[model samples]
Target: MSKQFFVTFCLLFITFYGKCQVTCSLPNKKAFETKIDSLNKIDLDSLNPSQKITSIAETFLGEPYMEKTLDIDIKKETVVINFTGFDCTTFVENMIALTKLYTGDQNEKYRTLEHYASILEHIRYRNGKLKGYTSRLHYFTDWVRNNQAKGIVKDITVEIGGQTYDKNIDFMSTHITAYDQLVKNDSAISAIRLIEDDLNQTPLSQIYIKDISKVESKIQSGDIIALVCNVKGLDVAHVGLALRKEDGRIYLLHASQSKGKVVITDKPLAEWLKNSKLNTGITVARLN
Candidate 1:
């Protein structure tokens, strides 16, 4: 082959490889289309971002809690969307993605599965690029920081009566055997360790369980709440959306592990946190 032709061929090959890397798994295509059509008909112009989020989140109230739905393949990272079931992180991510989709302009380009995938990829991965398994935001604090940088969210932990949560985060790297991808992968483990090191440098801020009651007034509905864990080497145990109900108190809207489905907690936010011995406090992020 001629030098120029060879170079062009290589470039084309690379482009094809990059485009083929992401495999999207939309389990319920008809449901997805129906939901999208419904969102398109809604008068989102009257609602703010928070209202949009809560409105979107409430639609998935009965979604079964399924762990590791994102782990579509052990070798390849797929943009997996399961409206039928959601883990806590997936529930939060999907709610935010759907709200963004609902609130965005009604251009034909914006109303496609690919556009939704692009939005989800931006929200789920680091700097919105999916390089590999490690590219996924494993840490909730990291997720908040990256999304904040992208103008998707603003970390309101410090603004709402929070204090420094000084601790090292290395749970994933240390517990590599627990993760299928990291069980024998040295490179992935190394990358996670580096991420953990960076996280340790910046102390996270959280509203203590004792102080959450005082700051309940500030936490608005549709705000993302990360349950900061007391567990060693873990920054966040779980995450969900905050909902201020008619009774004038904040409640958690999350994919509950114990309940095996997505549901609003019966108790208020403060009481819920107080009940969990594993949870230390909360890191709040509001959609921007």
Candidate 2:
């Protein structure tokens, strides 16, 4: 996607939310802590992680993409530049970095550079060469499911964003910034975060999808489906995870600029089905 398209998408994405589908809530810090504690003891192999992850992910329900830069607690470490880097995809990068640190990996200082890494490379490193960055692959759902299959991370549900999510259902979301929409208006104060991947650059060909079958099999609860709009180049717009599937319609939750804020909705992929190019792209991949 060109810089022109990127900015345009960002501008229009939030406007989509102005249409207003359903109202969502954010969990308080107290609720967040209680839910995460539950994840510490679950036998990940026996159950799904969506609800568990969703519980906490929702705490950031309405956060902006740039607030992550300002929210980190750095313990008064010579504040030079307090950047507001709140974005859904980057938030996921931060979470992955923290998880790696939790695993106690000696390489990359565990929490330092890993948080900023791109989704493809992160998955490739975690899953290795066999899963070399899949270009057409878009959204965190695809990556999380892949990791779950390899046992790199497990899912569990906890309270977040004032809503209870089944960890199994959590896998279907993207990260967004949580800030004061009124005061911050365009900003949020972040405590010097230790996470933020320098490598998690957005790909032009990436887009969000609700149906996994469009690109792969099973649009499972936690898969991040990418709806590719890049008929000519790389994917341009990406929402969050493909979380809910209902009434034969797949629903997703993400920090959409299209909605001008964080939102949950269904029917995007269904709408795309009418496009001829999309129909062909999906078919070609199946044959390949």
User: What is the TM-score of each predicted model, taking all chains together?
Assistant: 0.90, 0.37
| Prediction 1 global C-alpha lDDT | 0.85
Query: What's the residue-level lDDT of 152 in candidate 2?
Result: 57
Q: Which ten residues in a row have the lowest lDDT in candidate 1?
A: 11-20
Q: Which is the leading candidate under lDDT? A: 1
Write model 2 residue lDDT over 75-189, tens digit each, in one string: 2111111112235554444333334333433333322221322322344333422221122123343444445555654322111101121112111112223222213322211
For each of the candidates, the C-alpha root-mean-square deviation to the true structure, in angstroms, is 8.2, 17.3
Off by over 4 Å in 1: 1-26
Provide the global lDDT of candidate 2 against the true structure. Answer: 0.34
* Clash count, predicted structure 1: 0
* Model 1: pairs clashing at backbone N, Cα or C within 3 Å: none
For candidate 1, the TM-score is 0.90
